[model samples]
Target: MFQTDSENDSAEPHYLRLRNQIANEIEAGILSSGARLPSERKYHELIGSARGTVREALSQLEAEGLIYRKDRSGWYVSPKPVTYDPTRWSGFMTYVAEQGRLPATETLQVKTEKQPPAILDIFGKGVRNPLYRVERRRSIDERPVLVEDITINPALAPGLARHNLNGSLSGVLRDVYGLVVTRNHVEMRACALVRHTAECLGVKSGTPGLLVIRTSYDARGRVIEYDQEYWCANAIRIEVDLTVA
Candidate 1:
């Protein structure tokens, strides 16, 4: 591992030193997601600091969702940070392309996995029952921007493979399936990027990332699509448009 500044030997709290060093590594992309940090003792020796100091720093980082401890394992870097916009009703590809970057999808994994238990519990269905899933790394101006895992009603849009994914799913839903999207119900929260997300987005595990839960509705107010997008912090920003009545 490429080590940076070690903790100062002064009586300053040891955890602060650890926090500063780890934070620096994350911002620099040196200690990316899934990057395992040295053990507490290792950190102590590496920084010529006390074990308690290293422990304190690790604790704070974990609490902030910057690092996590594994069973029989150690701490690791989180994935890319995520940014979300609660104001925009447009879909992911549409919102991103409007920013002037061409949209693309690599289709890393698209088969189907059991819907997360919480999701299944809420929807009360097979959960994974025939969801049209498409996972991709979203980018802007050729710079990595976000990773999107979108799931839609396969019954609504049966022939997903025939659609041109380079553009927006909403467009396809409108033009091909004739299911016009008019609105969406959305929510936002803070979370840490786990192993998979961290590896793909090039951040660390337990790193702070945005969590978006949205249900897109069509002209008939029917929930046709649901999506989760893990966006890098600096990749994009959302601004609300206002009008004076």
Candidate 2:
């Protein structure tokens, strides 16, 4: 049902024309989210273009976040990314729920490790404390989107490893330890997906993504947790509210 004969008259490159045709179909609702795209060979036949041309067009679409590829699987239209507000104090489940999407976390690993230099710098020198390292994969609407590595101060919340780590850590800190997170110091930057992260998110290494480092403090200004979260760039949209005095 999709044709590009009329586009041949244009001056655009063959791949560009093919890319625009597919993009138009996606925008016009002819292709739905999660819909599998035609195979590269099939597309070449349909558009009367070279196979390499079809591949280039698909690669372009993937780079633009209009589509994504699964390992050993072909490309599919990307779903709309989730909107996130970093200023909000609520946890992942809360914000995702507000957007009418299901949220889930899979705890990958939890163990004790010596405090890293960066964390020790924040907590101050002369402190010898063993920290709990937690690794988790987070999903929204059943789609894997984020991977997190959290370091917890055991002195602040002893026996934290005994509880379920798949749920909200903030909730556990508040309800069990009475350590409420009052403020957070956060830094954000663009990063490429590492091997471990790519395997977890089912994406290729070197894919562009967002990296967030957050240090949460309790009411008394005590550092409670240090977290590093890697998010698929196409799976989230970051928003912040700003005010000028």
Candidate 3:
């Protein structure tokens, strides 16, 4: 029943402007899961547009899985994207909690190690960093969300498990290792889940997931963690939120 159009960007066409306005509300978490969207008549009033224009916007949203319309009951908001908040300092647990979902971790392996060459390139340095291999699966409300293989330089966080592998690595590094993360570089691409990865993540080998390659550095600009996260493809739509100074 609320207005959708804004005077901020008046140059755009009325229907397109309305569509974007409604879409942003869905993305921002203000309009929550299962909340029925206003009727066409209501949206027409809200956007100061024609009924046909409002219907076009609604149709687009429905096609994109952002909302759905019942035969007679009208439109309702889609579920929130599987929450993967970039603003958070913590990992899956903190993010899940913020979204009101319970989180659990499956720790498959944690072992001291030397640097791996492929990972060395990711860190952009020599492979002599003295590292450990940490493999785990993170789940949201008992549903698998991510499978992570982290190569952490022991020099950064001595006896990393002494802090906690089940929760925030960023916090542990800062609290125990006295290191602050100043940089993070992420690269995402699509790949088929391998048998090993899929088995750990409860998906099939052919299942598509996002392979996220990441390098994290301390405030001193030292590479600390070189990791790959296999996120369930259906779990989230990662977006960059940026602002100009």
Best model per lDDT: 2
The global C-alpha lDDT for each of the candidates, from Candidate 1 onward, is 0.67, 0.86, 0.74
Query: Candidate 3 residues 40-123, lDDT tens each?
Result: 887787667789888888877765667766569989885555655455455666766877877787777888876657766766
Candidate 2 local lDDT, 13-130, one digit each (tens): 9898889889998888788878998888889778787788899999999988889887668989988787888888778888888888899999999888987687788866555667
Off by over 4 Å in 1: 1-85, 90-104, 112-128, 241-245
Q: Model 1, residue 72: displacement in angstroms?
A: 28
Candidate 3, residue 22: Cα displacement in angstroms equals 20
Error of 1 at 22 (Å): 19
Positional deviation of residue 10's Cα in model 1 after best superposition, in angstroms: 24
TM agreement with the true structure for every prediction: 0.57, 0.84, 0.62
Write the residue-wise lDDT of candidate 1 on 1-245 in tens digits: 42434524566565675687788888788888669987888877777666777788888887666766667688877544333356765655665566555555555666554566665453445435646677777665554556778876667788776666756767777788888767777776666678888788776666667666677777666666777887654444445567898
Error of 3 at 166 (Å): 1.1
In model 2, what lDDT does residue 112 have? 88
